[model samples]
Target chain A: MYRYDEFDHAFVQTRVAQFREQVEARLAGQLTEEEFRPLRLMNGLYLQLHAYMLRIAIPYGTLSARQMRQLAFITDRFDRGSAHFTTRQNLQLNWPKLIETPDILAALAEVEMHGIQTSGNCIRNVTSDQYAGVAADEIEDPRPTGELIRQWSTDHPEFSFLPRKFKIAVTGAAMDRAAVAAHDIGIRVVRNDAGEVGYRIYVGGGLGRTPMLARLVREFLPKDDLIAYLEAIMRVYNLFGRRDNKYKARVKILMHEAGTETVKRMVEEEFARLPRAAINVDPAELARIEAYFAPPAYEALGDEPALLAAARQADAGFDAFARANVVAHKQPGYAIVNISLKPIGGAPGDATSAQMRAVADLSERYGFGEIRVTHAQNLVLPDVRQRDLPALYRELLAAGLGDANAGLITDIIACPGMDYCSLATARSIPIAKAIAQRFANPARQQLIGELGIKISGCINACGHHHLGGIGILGLEKGGEESYQITLGGDPGNDAAIGKLLGPGLAGDDVPDAIERIVDLYLAGREAGETFVAAYRRLGHDHFKGALNADRH
Target chain B: MPIVTERGFGPDGWATVADETAVADGGDVIVSWKRFVAEAATLTGRAGRIGVAVGPDFDVDLHVAGLDGVALVAIAFAKFADGRGFSIARRLRDRGFAGTIRAVGPLIAEQAPMAFACGIDEIAIPDDLAARQPESRWLRAVELRAAVSYQRGYRTGASVFDQRSTGGAA
Candidate 1:
């Protein structure tokens, strides 16, 4: 986790005071609703359909145990008893009042957190692989860069009021767990042939009314010119990006409508005009950020061959959890553990304050006092040693988060649809819970491996449904909530948008539609091939035909 | 006493004059419109001392881009919540609309901070607005918490970013 430096601390303090004054003005009726809307949004407060939702950024999805406890306190004090963890790896409190937001911000400031730039046409929270520092295949940790961008994009004057909300993600892992390809700006840290580190920059990728895989703007941007290159891209977008139609206003639309070649030329021209670097980023500063993320200490222990063998033989539950939730780590005797926030028959990604505190305690006890929230809405104890897995699992089971379904079909990514959001046409959480419960069989789930089913409440694509291998969009037809399924979508190194599968299904018929799709994949796929690969080979028309078979 | 400047457009450029007969004098004050309505012979040109007042919702590029002979462009808030005026001011700076660009209407004393952030050099507060203890121009205490002014948008990243200046003058 990147701890706040003095500069970060001072900046947050001043912002708290500044927003406090804005609240005062709004309360006194001096500031009209139109006047106060942008300001409120900038601070991560939104007047949603039901009540005000205050979104707090868990920057890059990293949080300390203390910070987790503080979040619990915020929900308990200023809002309802819990908070909703978003697909963006941020958290939202759905019931905080306008008057209480400043006080809530003041409390967050005490914990070195504030909601500045969390919303409203600014560079949003920078996300990355939740297991970046501990992932086995990662080239290097990506948090340092995530933090760097976090600081630079905060309170930016010129780029504040952009075409729309902008999102950036970075990753060091070769597998791209951050979904780098789907962000407005995605950077992958790579080592050059000279053994020097640089970045692979992709721009204009986003999911909304329009879904796009960010085009590669720079194959290798030097470590020194990250800021300049970013500035260059933003400059081009700001100058030439569309602002006439709100729907066609994102940089992705600009890249698409203006043609990538022209946008690239504009970016190149702007990059040439930038001033030279003076950020004073030395090896020492890198080391300082790295120190905060240093690998957790481990014992030089023999292989856990005996325990693993015994567990495989004695307990099918242990084998299922091992087969489902655990991912391989680079270090011997260590495993990256995912504490599932989505239990079978539970709403995906809804972590209570107590659950948050419990996860924090478990992290400190068996793993490090570090926690991470994945884009798939799972909390990861990234550096847990192999020996500590059992104890951690026990604690997690007690906390109701030990579902042991990390990548399985049951581990669904879903948004708070009509239940919470005013924009949603259909309910998402109930559908997710229903689907997860239906696919609760461990053997059956393992049979359908590496599958991602993302459910969004609407077309806004907040659930990254457009990026899912099988995206389910909830819609309202004649006032009844229905589910629309799309196929061939993916969010990985080879990212692509999903294709819709005809008309939406009745809410009662959603699980059957999903099963029908999975059954099609199962019946016609080659051995060891994932659902997405099989879909790409066979195409969405086949899956649609399979899902809508009963109609014709 | 407060003045409600109800600006409208004619073949002549931007003007607050609702009565066509009253605007004939042009008075000691210059004239301008609330929006850019295309008319071959509308309003005064940039060459004259005529000042244009842009409504909070008007596109800045329309006014800033055609400033070849425009003397001064004044932006109106209509109401304080209108952020379009701030952006209009920035566009003026970017396009090199060096002539005076002021913030008018129910602009509050609090928005004085954002006014400076968007390159608003001057503010025209409503006459009815309760004057702050010492008033807010020239002699007020400079209250900046950050190293730079109006740095609260996308440029919030720790690294340096670019601002488009193509709309402004050379």
Candidate 2:
């Protein structure tokens, strides 16, 4: 985990002061609600249906145990004893009063955190692979790159008020766990044939009312020219992206309207004109940022300790947990433990204050004093030694964090829909809950094998419904809540948006429809094929009848 | 309307002329982009300095060659949330426009630091907005923002990276 330097501390503290004044001005009626909306949104404060939601950025999904404890404290003190982790790997408190938001920000600043750029039409919190440095397939750690972008985009003078909100995701691993294809800008840290590290840049990808996969604008951008190239892309978008229609204001629309070739030429021209030497980061600064992400000290130990194997054999629950939640690590003796937040029949990503504190303690006790928030709305302990898995599992079970469903159907991603969001036209959490209950049996889930069901209450696609293996979108049709199903979407290397299946089904019939689809997949899939892989081979035609079955 | 520069409020130095209005011979005057383009050669040696007021959609690259003797480029923000003016100002500076760049519209006080940092010399706000948010708020915004910035190569003070390289406090 990266520690905040003196400069970082001062920067966050000053931002707190700045937002404090803005809040005071709003309360005093010196600024109207319309004028204060963007300011508060820049600080990650949103006025939801019931209250103000304060979203705190967990930069690159990395958090120290101390920071987790502070988040727990904030949850207990200001919010209603819980918080929802978002699809972007950030945390949101749904009940913070507007007057108390400045205090919340000040508390976050104490822990090397702030809500800056988490929302509003600016470059948002830069996300990366949650298993950044610890993954086995990584070429280089992407956190340093993520951090550099974070610093560069924070209160950026030239791009603070973009035409629309911008998101950037980076991945250093071949697996692409960050969903880089769904971001406004995606950077893949790759090594060229000559073994020099560089970036493969993708632009114009986003998911809202319109879903788009990014196009490869730069086949290979030199490692040193990262900031300058990004500046060029942003400048072109800021100047040319449509502002007349808010729905079509993303960089993707710009790329679509202007043609990628013209956009690429414009970016190249701007890059050529920019003072590269002045804007490009110094090599020393890059080295300094990289130093923070160097791998932690490890002890020489063998893989799959005897005790863990014996514990797995003795306890069926432990065996199931090890099979689902434990992931391979680069270091032989270590494993990545994904603590599932999606318990059956529970909200997808809500964690109680106690659960947060428990995870915080477990991080310090079992591994390094660090934790990670996954884009799938889960928590990760990235450095847990294989020897400590048994004890960690037992403690996690006691805290009710021992759900053995990492990529299973029960591990659904859902947005805070009509239940909490003013933008939602239908309820999403209940749909997620109902689907999870339908597949609650562990044996059944294991048989299904790695299916992602994402639900969104509206077209905003906050839950990333478009990227799920089985996407369920809630819409209001004929004055009734209806759910639409889509299949074959992926968030990985072969990223593709899911195609709509058929007519919408009533909310009560959603779970049964999903079960029919799963049944069809089970009947059609070949040996050892995942849902997405099977969908690709079987094609959309094979599953077209799942929702339209005469089950009356 | 009041013009806010880095130094608090400044006096307006030029008169803005509509597109159909005829230019007078004596004092400094600002004209629309159409008027400037149609009469670029005549405006170059006029008795007064000439400035151009461009809309948000104004393409700087298409008109850069004709702005030789222009004393100022005033970028308009039709709405405060519409941020095309900031990039346009940067484009002008990047294209080697060695003249004053001003933003004119219903901009709030908090956007002053960003406007200044993006190469805009000053901002001209509507009288209503100026009345609500006085010059003191704008000055305070600029002062607070001057304390620290992480971005490099802007018109602001030393960036955090620059300070780090020189071993100075950020």
Candidate 3:
């Protein structure tokens, strides 16, 4: 993790003081709610359905054990006993009072954390692959770039009040773990023919009422011009983006109305005007940022550890967990373990304060003192040794984090629905819980295999329903909660938006509707075929027929 | 009527020329962009300075050439949340507009720092908001924190980034 320098510390301190003053002014009635609304939003305080929600950014999805423990403390002190991890790799404390928000922010600042730019119309929390530096297939570690962008975008004077909220994601690996294609600006670091690393820039991809894949703006942008190029894009959007309608204000709408070529031309013209020599990051500063993410010390070891093999052979539960949750690490003896927050019949990403402390303790003891929050709303212990798998599994089971459902059908991604969100039309957590319960059998989940079921409370698509292989959208129809299912969406390198399956089903019937689709996929799948692959091979028509069979 | 500048509350220097009203008596007057374009030749030949108030939809590039001798430019923020004026002000500054640039509307004191940083010389706040927030809040917006900005030139010239890129002290 990149430790805060003197500048970073001073910057956050000043921000905390500024927000405290603003809150005081609001309480004194000097600033109206209308005036203080945007002010609060920029600091990540949202007036949700019930209480104020504070969303804190874990930069590049990386968190230290100390930071994790700090979040646990915040959860125990300010919020209800638990905090919700979001799809943007952030944590949201749902029950804080408006008055206590300043104290919460102050506490976070103590641990080198702040909720800056996690919400409102600004360049939001920059996200990258959760397994960024540890992934074996990575071309380069994406954290340095993520950190650089984080610094450049924070408190940016000109680009702060954009037409709407903007999100940027980066990925260095060949497989897109960050879901780069679904972001407003997706950057992939690629090596040129001469072995020079630069970025392949994609712009305008987003999911909402309108889901569009990002188009390739610049095939290759030199690494030095990253900030300048991003400025050019933002300037074009801020100047030309439509602000008449709130729904039509995202950059995707601008790229849609004005053709991609026209948008590119405007951005290029703006880029030509910017002083690139001044705008690009210095090579020395880049190196300084990259040094923070360098690999940890590793002991030379042979292949698989004998203890891990014996443990796997002895305990079925341990073996299932090892098979489902553990992934190969860049180091030979180390492994990346994903701690599932989605237990059957529980909210997708809600973790209690005790569970958080347990995870923090485990990260400190068995792995490096680092934790990562995945965009899929799970926690990652990225440096666990293979030999410690059984003991870790026992501890995790005691903490109730031992669900062997990582990447399986039972591991669902869901957003806070009408139960908590003001904009939601229907509840999403209940449906996700019901589906997980229906598919609770491990054998059934393994047989179904690698199916991503994402649910959103509304068309806002915060749960990334547009990228799920089995997508469910909850909406209101004639004052009743209705669910709509979509098929074949994938957030990988070959990203595609899911297509609609049929009409909306009632909330009670959503689980059965999902089961029907899953059963159809299982029946038609060939050998070694994932749900997405089978969906592609058999087309949406077959799934559409299966979904509509009992409804009509 | 209090106007906010970087140096705190300052006196309003130029008078505004409303489209429907008669011309102001003696001091320099800023007119709308429409009036500026239609009466450019006559206004340019005047003895004192001429200024223009541009709406949110004003295209600075198309009319920048017409603003040759204009001493002041005012961008309108019809609503506080509608931030098109900030972009326009920055664009004018980027194009080397050296004259006074003022933000005219009901924006609150919290946005004073943002507007000033985007190259606006002063902010013309509505009476209601000005009375509500006062000048202290706006002055606090400009308090320097002393941390080097990572971004390149937008409002201020030559930040630490520019210095580092030019082989200055790292």
Candidate 4:
């Protein structure tokens, strides 16, 4: 919802022209492949298996209806009629040719969008809780702060060429919906006892080959000093983050080696030495940024749940959807509706261009024209009137988005694995598709409710398997694809890294392993306890018993 | 006296020996370590339009002020990704150094607009690349958005010791 300022417009324009020349030079053979690789990557263009893939930044996942249309248009024109909505809240078109890249960039820029910093060994597209502003339990709307960091990190001269790629996610909710616990810098928005909103800083947590849950660096960082404080943290990481091995270059490793106490001391000492002017966060500017994320227009009405419950009594599907997908909105008479991108057995979060347009239009009609993409790979129409839920559900069902599996077992978060990502060692989407088919039973799904099945193609953890209660990692052993299952992972207030159960399982056996985990959860989980809590109480030994019962 | 064999010039072109006095004065002019701090005043403006190329080594504001009235061509040093010169060029422009702030470096083609975006009005590439590469053609693609991006750091306190030295002048 942030508008392009003079600074933002100018910066992107310069970058487009800069990349334009680089592309021309590469085509003309003036620059070698090695030289052009990083340059194009910095602009968010990657030469993939088939053609060039342009990963465009969604800017903390805030996009207008028109912007969504533009994405749809780009997909229909340049890509193969569908674009992939990534876990980072960006869209990647698989077939954008090298020749069509500049045009794609130009088209994106026309709408105040760009692909800068979505790739390369630099700071990446900042992720935020999709329900950031409208979350009922939020301390503050974290998007404006996210926008500020987005600007500060874009084409940043010093840290753009870092030891490795860096990612940052922010969440206003005490729930930590943005998965901040797994980012290089996960900022949780918090309010002090004095009622002033600030941040609880978590540093060094990341999901790659080596997954480390971020340690809390500060209890409360004043809103004004967010950037300044972050600067201190990054300086510590930039200087000390391992450069010898690319795999170990993440700040998480550095924070691990140095420990939270040492890092906290270094950050504080460095922050003090930093000129106050350099770290200066003007209150007025902060207020101005806040203006961009102004609160939604709330309408007061009497009991919507009563009316919705009456409507739901007539329809079973509506009742099921209401039970699963629909969440209580902060405002009265409104509900936050989660339209599942995961159709039964379909790839998780893979929305067709047409589907995106449908969601964009539905957003305008039922809720405000604001759609949010959650970390679970589901889209939320955050402010739907309860009166409109039945109507919206009907419309979404027609559009193939009303899957009613918001947090159900079928609401799986799987990475693009070998299908798209070069880093993936195995195919993740097929496994996810297969699992969805197996758990396709709606009653069975509802019975085994609140279960998380996250799949990563490899140990790189792009699919965030490390955070899923039933984590699945796809790996290749010998000539065949295999999977390793982890249990009790989470991305909430009590964030904890997933514990590995045992050795890897064959690809065909993954779904069975998942079934066994769910069966155990269904059997042993106490009344109303979720998989995570059950696993917490039962520990790895209980899950180990379940996994040992299954064989290829 | 260390022999001063200069390679680049004023208006950000190639440096040349103007005359016999240029040789005597220039031979001792070891451009390295000639910050205004070490050398005394009065003799500072003796070198004709001689400005120190601003890298991380020297502050442009200080060097420009000491060499008052001497036009300083902000040399980019290299056209391919050596961006320190843009900082030099921006600082020179911000500090009201009315001198010709030209970018002279290797791989100077198509970077003219980027140079201009950072406030460089003049550019001088390596003679060989310059001969083969048409720098004027790069001007046709003038950018609409222009901001002086010299001291933009990832973290505000992102210096060597976590102390921020970002946005040195602004």
Q: Model 4, range A131-237, lDDT digits (tens) per residue?
A: 77877888788898898788767655445546688899988886778888899999988888999888899888888889988888899988878877876676556
Tell me the TM-score of each prediction against the true structure: 0.84, 0.99, 0.97, 0.82
What is the C-alpha lDDT profile of model 1 across A1-552, one tens digit per residue? 677665566667777777887787677775567667878988999888899999999888898888889999998898778788888889899999888898999899888888877788778999999888888888989998887777767765556667678899999998998998888899999999998888999989988778889998888988777766786687566555676787787889988988888888878865674442432233345556667777768667655767776765776766777777888877788787887778888888888888988987877876678889889988888777777666677777888887878888988999988898988988999999989988988789988998999999987888888988889898778888777788888898888899988787887788887888899999889999999999989877778765564331
lDDT of 3 by residue, A1-552 (tens): 798876677678788888999999999998999889888998999999988889999989999999999999999999889999999999999999988898999999999999999999999999999999999999999999999999889888778888899999999998899988898999999999989999999999999999999999998898988998998899889888988897899888999999999999999998998677757777778888899998977778655767787998899889889988998898898899999999999999999999999999999998879999999999999998888888999999999999999999988999999889998999999999999999999878877879899999999999899999999999898898888899999999989999999988888888888888988898999998999999999999888765564452
TM-score of chain A of each: 0.96, 0.99, 0.99, 0.97
Tell me the tens digit of each residue's lDDT in model 1 across B68-157: 545556777665533456656665665566776666766654455556555665665554453331242212212533233223221122
Model 4: CA > 4 A from native: A549-552, B1-145, B148-170
Q: Evaluate every candidate with DockQ and list the scores.
A: 0.10, 0.77, 0.53, 0.09
How far does residue A75 in candidate 1 sit from its true spot (Å)?
Answer: 2.3
lDDT of each: 0.74, 0.91, 0.88, 0.73
Candidate 1 interface CA RMSD, Å: 8.9
* Candidate of highest TM-score: 2
Which scores better on lDDT, 1 or 4? 1
lDDT of 2 by residue, A408-492 (tens): 9999999999999999989999999999999999988888989999999999999899999999899898788888899989999
Global CA lDDT computed for model 2: 0.91
Candidate 1 runs further than 4 Å off: A276-291, A296-306, A549-552, B1-120, B123-144, B147-170
lDDT of 2 by residue, B74-166 (tens): 999998898889989888888889899999998887889999988999899888877777788899889988988888878898898889988
